[model samples]
Each structure stands twice: as C-alpha cells, then as structure tokens.
Target: GYRTLRENDTGLNGALEIPAMRRLLPDLRGKAVLDLGCGFGDFARYARAQGAEQVIALDVSANMIDAARALTDDPAITYRHASIEDCTTAPAAFDLTVSSLALHYIADYPAVVQRVFDSLKPGGTFVFSVEHPVQTAHPVGWVRDADGNRLHWPLDHYQQQGARSTSWFVDGMIKYHRTMETYVNTLLDRGFQLRHLAEPCPPAEVLQARPDLEDTVRRPPMLILVATKPAKRK
Candidate 1:
C-alpha cells in the first residue's frame, strides 16, 4: 500500500502534503531541511523549491533511494540510503526534519520521532503525515454488494491504539499504527511543542481525477502534524 501510487512517487499524497507544506512553509524558507523517509524525493524537492537552504532526503529503501537519485541531481539536495532509526546525522544539525505519510511505517515510531527531535537545532521544526488510525483499525475488505457492484464492511472503525495491518510488503515487512493522542504525547515527551495538527480535506480536483476513490477526497484520508524542538538548555 505504501509503495503503490502515493504522493511521493506520484503526487497523490500531495493533496495532504501540499496543505501541510503551505501551512508550514512560512517557517521553513531559507532553513536547513531534512526529509525523513523521503521516498523518491518529491517533498524534498518541494522544500527546496519553497526556499529551504538545503534539503536531505533519507529513506531506508535502497531501491527507492536509487529512484530518487535518478529523478534529480540538484546540489542543494542530497539523498541518503539509511533507516531513520540508524542515521548518524550530526546532533542539532537541521532546522527542520519532515516525514510525509511515512512515520507509521516505522515499527517503533516514538523512538524514531525522538531521533528526529534529536537531529534538529533548538526550535527546529519537524512535520509529518500518516494514514488515519481510523483507516487502519477498521479495514474494509472488498466484496460484492447486493447489486453485485462493490461494498465495504465495518465503516468508521477506530483503533484506540494498535497496528491493524501490514499492507506494504517486500518479503514480509512490519509496520505500525498509533492514536492521535499516542502520537502527540510521544512528541511532547521528546520536547517538541505541538504547532499544527491537520486532517486533510482533498479538493474537488483530486476527486475528479481519481473517481474510483472519490470517497477519500470527500473526507480527509490522513493527518498532518508540525512540532518544534525546544532549544537545548545551557
């Protein structure tokens, strides 16, 4: 699911990302930026275009990193092939570190969030997007309806806190899910102050293009968050 038809590879998630970027860009221009799980470098390039001084795109997937390198050769952007949990980036090196629709894929999300927190300078920003826990908790299996068309069961299922599926696979990969409160608290505990929390409302343009899943466009499909690291104490 994550590797298929997403905003990173194809701008589908841009509906969710563009809005978060619009809201967060004012603070991002001319700052050092890092993109966690950067995919094929879409948002990293987007950050550079929006005026970030430098952008580093990092993801655990080597194939994905190779795909990213092939797409762009800008000097301002660097692509790193490494797991976010294991990167040795200098402490407090970035003005901002962001992940778009990527954090939930990490098995231990809170630890990695802290790692991202530790990577930034004082007051540096970290923004990210993830599938709605509600989407994960109550999954709809495709089946034939009474009219023999299409229908889904268990609408509006909310996971209080859990991982419901492992849809994204490459020889059996593991992933996770977290409630909004679980997510927010992890950042707060790591010294980040919540700045913005967004539930996307995909525009009519997106619906018109992807008519099959207009349902996602009619109601926001994901959540975005922006949090800031406090400057280190003397």
Candidate 2:
C-alpha cells in the first residue's frame, strides 16, 4: 500500500528530497549499488536507469520486497528481504550505498552507519535522508485556534533522545529520535568524510503546485547528507 500511501509526499519528497538527492548524488554509471531499507524499489529502479550495473534493494518488510520484486523485472536489480541491522554485505562490495527516509526508523544508527561504511568500496559514496532533528526533537504538534487555524508549533525536551511513537499511515508507528550532532558526529567517528548536508526546501514549482506547503519554510521536515568512504592509504 506504500504506492497508494505516498501521494501526500508530493511536496515533501517529490519536491524536496528527490531534487536534493539528484543534486547530491555522484554519477552511478556502471556502479554496484546498495539500497538500504529500499521500500518498494523505486529508488533502485531509478539507480538502474541512472546506469548502475547492479543494485541490491534490501528491506525489512516481506510485503515490501514482494512489491518491489513484482515491479522490477530488470536483471540488474535484486530484492532482498532483511532488516538493515541484520543484513550483511562483503567489504568493498559496492560503489555506492543509499537510503531515503529510513534512518529515523533505525534505532542503532551508529552501528548501521558503520555497516554501510564497511559495505562500500574505498572512496565510495553514501547518501541518505532522515526526518530532521528539529521535527524529531519533540512530540509536540501544531497548536491551532478554536477555528482550527494554526497558532504556533511547540517544542520541549529537545535534548532528550529516544523512541517516539506516532500514528501515520499506520497506528502506533515507532521512530527513533537523535540530535543532528549525533548523526553527523557518528558518521565522522566511523571514518566517513562528510561531503554535503542539506535541509532541503521545496522548489518554486513544488510550492506553486501546493501553496499550503508554504509552512515548510518555518520548519524543515527532512535532512539529507552525502559522505564518502576514505580510500586505502599508501
């Protein structure tokens, strides 16, 4: 049902995330790619179209893998049903590793980042997006007037980090919360060289399509990053 459930992302992902990724991603021609937490293989298919020779699309959900496999007939793509935590790949096996909007759901991001670092070839690229720390900093929601007009958003206990349960397409979904420092520092600690960081904004065309999303300017909903695995030293 992710295919049907994703319509709401017209502005957030379609406008912001996708554009940011296209700008950040290095050329993928003939690259061996790993897509961690690949939901329905949309991105994997895109990687193939971008000229990647092989792509492994891994996800924790069996249903999601099934959906991806059904849609992907390309011999270049392989769908694996596995959790990011348990999934394993040989060292220097891939030229690129990418994940989108999936890191927030992972509790042990540090370990997973290390895993990705190990999975990539030296000098390989890693790009991913997660819910912005500002958005994950608290459970607070928009405070609206009696007329249901927006008053203001509230923030509290931002320094506290842990699991947050909120309803979305599914009820009682759990997402992990971490500060931006934790995200950036852990990648550096694990030996990645940071390349780019982005708090993406919807393009004018996106804003024109959905004027209500003007509120995204007040707060960013996502954070995107690009990093590189260091090559072996002489």
Candidate 3:
C-alpha cells in the first residue's frame, strides 16, 4: 500500500517528506548504512546510488521485505524482516542510520533512540522523520466548513503523550504521540548532538502541482531531524 502510494509519487511522502529528508541527509559515499523500518527499501536503493558501501534494511512486515527484495538487485543491500523493537545490531556498526516516517509507530521512542545511538560509530549520523506532533497530538482529522472546505487543523491533548489510533490505508492503525520537547530531549539525553530540525512544507513546485497541499503550509504533517553521535575525545 505504501509502495503503491510512493510509486505514484503524488502523496505527501513523495512531494514533501522525502525531499525534506534528502535535504537533511549527509553524504553517503563509501559509508555503512542502516535503514530502520525500511518499508519497500526505497532509502536502501537511494543510499546505494549515493555510493554507500553497504546497507542493512529492516522492516517488520514480511510482505514489505519480499516486495523490496523483488524490486532490489543490489547485492550490497540486505533486507531483513524484523521489527525495530526486536532487531539487534552490533555496537558502532553503522556510519549512518536513518528511519523514515516510521518511529511514531514504535511505542518506545526513547529506547529506539538509545539503540540508534549505540549502533552508530563515533561521530556517525542519525536522520529520521516522523508524523509531526500536531497531527499525532489528536488525529481527529480536520475541521471543515459548511461547504466541506478545510477550515483549520484541530490540536488538543498535546501535553498527554501515549498511544493514539487513527486510520491510514487501514483503520485503527496505532501510533505513539510525543511532544516536540520529548523528541529533541530524548536525543540530547541519549548523547546525540542535535544537528538540524525541520517541519518542512511542500516546496513551490510541489504546491503548484498539488494545490490541495496548501493546508500543509499551515500545519506541517512531518518532522525531520538530524543528530550525530559525539566523536570520542582523544
């Protein structure tokens, strides 16, 4: 379902999230990469194209792994069917670790951040995106006027953080909600130096092509962040 949406290249992920992620990502040349919640292996392929020496792509869904495997031909990119919660990595294994729009689905955000920190080599980078807190704070959809025009986004329960269920391609999909403070502070607590933070809006070209995305400018749907492990002091 995500593959279909992404391949169509018409959704927010393609038009907004992916572009923001690419902008925040560092150079991949000859680096070892780890892609958490790799989905259909899109980032794995992109990393290889950017000259990453190797990529370990992991997804919780076997179907996603199979689809990715079928689409991928690069021997350097390995696909594993494993949940981010359950998967284990050798310490300091990757030069770059990335997760795209998947961390919100995980309940233990702090644990994941800690794991990512431990899995990175000293000075390694971590870049990831998640559903913005505004959207996740209350996934009650939008407020509409009498003519069914979107009036504005409704935000409530921001201070309360925990599980929230909302529909996507399917109904009752669960996602954990965390405040912006929690997200940034978690990385800081885990010894990551914050590099950049972005709540990206669709670019001009994207808005010109998809006028429906005008609401995104008012309230961004995705949050992209970059943090790096501190290099050991000599």
Backbone collisions counted per model:
1, 0, 0
Model 3: residues >4 Å from true position, as ranges?
none
Q: Which candidate tops TM-score? A: 3
Query: What's each prediction's TM-score?
Result: 0.82, 0.95, 0.96
lDDT at position 220, candidate 1: 50
RMSD in Å for all candidates: 3.4, 1.5, 1.3
In model 1, the runs with Cα more than 4 Å from the true position are 1-4, 7-11, 141-144, 148-162, 204-213, 217-219, 231-234
Winning candidate number (lDDT) = 3
Model 3, span 3-30: residue lDDT tens: 6766775568788888889988889999
lDDT of each: 0.75, 0.88, 0.92
Candidate 1 TM-score, true structure as reference: 0.82
Error of 3 at 123 (Å): 0.4
> For model 1, how does the per-residue alpha-carbon lDDT over 114-134 read when each residue is reduced to its tens digit?
788878999788888887666
Candidate 2 per-residue lDDT over residues 78-162, each given as its tens digit: 9999999998999889999999999898989989998999999999999999999888877566778999976866676678888
Candidate 3 total steric clashes: 0
Candidate 2 Cα errors over 4 Å, as ranges:
none
Candidate 1 residue pairs in backbone clash: 7-13
Query: What's the best-to-worst order under lDDT?
Result: 3, 2, 1
